[model samples]
Target: MSKTLVLMRHGKSSWKDNLPDDERLLKKRAYKDIEHVASAFKHCLDKDFVFKSSYAERAESTAKHFLKQLGIPETHLHIESDLYTFDESSLKAFLYTVDDSLDNLMLFGHNPAFTNLANALGDQYFDNLPTSGLVMMHFKNSSWKDLASGKTILHLFPKNLR
Candidate 1:
C-alpha cells in the first residue's frame, strides 16, 4: 500500500513582544489562509485522514482551524512537542513511527525544519516555505521507514493559491 503525506507550516502569528513565544496566536490573516487551505482539502477530509500538529500555540491554533473546516474531530489530531522548533530529524523519526494503517496524513509545524524535511524527502530545495505553505507527497510504499530523499509528488504554497 502507498501512503500520502501532507506537510504544512503554521499560519502567520502575532509578534507582540508581551506574549511568550509559545503563547503567540495566529493573526487574522492567518486564519483566512488556514480556511482557504483547508477548503482545498475537503475531499480528503471527508474520507477521514490523520492529522498531527506541533504543540506550540500557533501550530495548534492552525490545526484547530483546519479540523473545523474539515469537520474532523479533535481526537484525530496528535499534538507533538518535538515539532515546535527546528527539528527535522525528529520530525523524520516521528514520520517513521506513524501507523501503517494510516495512508493519508497531514503534519502542521514550523518553518525551516518543515521546509528542510520537504526538500530532503523530495530531492529538491525550496527557498523558503512561507506561512501557511503546504506540500503533498506520495510514497510508493506504505512504510514510512522506506521514505528517502527526493520522492515528492507535489508541492503547493499559499502564494500559489492566489
Candidate 2:
C-alpha cells in the first residue's frame, strides 16, 4: 500500500524570560498561520492519519491546534520526546517504529531537520521550512520500515500563505 508522510515544523514561538525553549508556546502569527495551514489542509485529510509530534510545547501546540481545526481525533496522536531531534536521521528512525496498518502519518517537528527531511525524502528541495511549514511526501512502499525518498505532493509554509 502507498503511504503518506506529512512533516510539519512547529509554528513560531514566544520567547519568555523564564520559560525553557521546550516550554515556549505559539506566538500570535504562529497561531494564525497554523490555523490557516490546518484549514487549507483539511480537505485532503483522511481518517488513516497517524499523528505524531515532538514533546516540546510549541510542537504540541501546533499539532493540537491543527487537529482541533481539522476535527481530527486524538486517538493516534503521539507526543514523543524521541522526535525532538536536530537532524532527519532520528525522524526517519522514528518513522520505522510506526505500525504498517496505518498508511498516512503526520509528523510535527523542528528544523533544520524538517527542511532536510523534505529534501532528502522528497522530489523537491527547499532552502528552509518556515514556521508552521508542512511537506507531504508520497511513498510507494507498503511498509514504513521500507520508506525511501518519495515525491513531494504538497509543500506549504506560513510565508506561502502570506
User: Which candidate gets the maximum TM-score versus the true structure?
Assistant: 2
Q: What lDDT does model 1 reach?
A: 0.82
Cα lDDT of all candidates, in order? 0.82, 0.88
Worst 10 residues of 1 by lDDT: 40-49
Error of 2 at 78 (Å): 1.6
Residues 57-136, model 1: lDDT tens digits: 99999998888887778888899887787778988888888888888888999878898888888765788878888887
Question: How many clashes (backbone N, Cα, C below 3 Å) per candidate?
Answer: 3, 0
Q: What TM-score should be assigned to candidate 1?
A: 0.89
Q: Which one wins on lDDT?
A: 2
